[model samples]
Target: MPYSPEDKKRAVMRLRRIKGQAAALERAVEEGTDCKSLLQQIAALRGAANGLMAEVLDSHLRELFGSAKETVAVREARDPDEEIEALMKTLRTYLK
Candidate 1:
C-alpha cells in the first residue's frame, strides 16, 4: 500500500535530516575533521538511514498483514505467514 499523507510527511522529514547529515559529512571531509569525529558522523548517518528503512518496512508489513480493516477477499489472496517469512529472510540477508 502507498504511504498515507502523514507517513509521506514523516518520511520526507527523515530524508531531509539524512540529507543534512550527508552535507555535514561532506563538509567535515573538506575541512579535514579528525578521524574519530568523522567516524562518529558516519555512524550516525548510517543509523538514521537504517532507522528510516526499518520504519518503512514496518509500515509495509502493517499494510500487508496487520490491518484489521482489510477486506476478507483481500486477506484471502495472500499468505501472511509466508510473506512474513520471506520478509524475514530478506532482512536477515540484508543485515548480514
Candidate 2:
C-alpha cells in the first residue's frame, strides 16, 4: 500500500534528513570525529530508518486488514497456524 502524494512527500522529507545525516557522518569521519559520537549518530540514523519502515508496514497492514484491532478479527477468522505460515512466506518473498 503506497502512500498518497502528501504522505509520500512527508516520507521523502524524512529520507532527505537521513541522507543529510549520512553525509554529516562522512564529513565527521574525514574530520576525525570521535568513534563513539559517530557510532551514536549511526545508531540514530538506523532508528530513523526503522521508524520509517515501521510506518510503511503499518500502512500496508491497515490497507490489508483495515486497522490494528481489525487485524485481530481477521486473524481470528483464519486458521492461526496457516496464517502464520502464509505471513512468513509473504515476508520471505517481500524480502527477496
Candidate 3:
C-alpha cells in the first residue's frame, strides 16, 4: 500500500517500540532473568509483532481491493491524447 506520510511515521514508530521490546527481551535472556519475567516479555513482544502484522496485512488488503477505484479515477482524469499515447506505448511494449 502507498501509505500517507503520517501512516508511514506511525508504522515506523510502532516498529521502533517493538524493536525496543525485543532488545529488552534479549537482555533479559542473556542475564538469566526469572522465568516469569521472561515469559511476560515474550508475551508483550509477540503481541506487538502480531499487532504490526495485522496492520500491514490490513493495509495490503485495502490496497488490493481499493486500487480499482483509484485506477478508474486516474484513467477518467487523463487527457484523451495522453491516454492514446499510453495505450500506444503499451501496445508497442507488448508487441516487442
Candidate with top lDDT is 1
lDDT of each: 0.87, 0.75, 0.75
Q: All candidates' TM-scores?
A: 0.81, 0.67, 0.66
Report the Cα lDDT for candidate 3.
0.75
Ranking by TM-score: 1, 2, 3
Q: Work out how many backbone clashes candidate 3 has.
A: 0
Candidate 2 — which residues are off by over 4 angstroms?
67-86, 89-96
| Comparing 1 and 2 on TM-score, the stronger one | 1
Error of 3 at 94 (Å): 35
lDDT of 2 by residue, 32-82 (tens): 999999999899888878777766766665555555556566767866676
**Model 1 TM:** 0.81
**Model 1: how far is 90 from its true place, Å?**
3.6
In TM-score terms, which candidate is top?
1
Off by over 4 Å in 3: 67-96
User: Which should have the higher TM-score, number 2 or number 3?
Assistant: 2
Give one digit per residue, the lDDT tens place, for model 3 in 52-92: 76677667556544555577776567576765575567446
lDDT for model 1, on a 0 to 1 scale?
0.87
Candidate 1 residue-wise lDDT at 29:
99
Each candidate's number of clashing pairs is 0, 0, 0
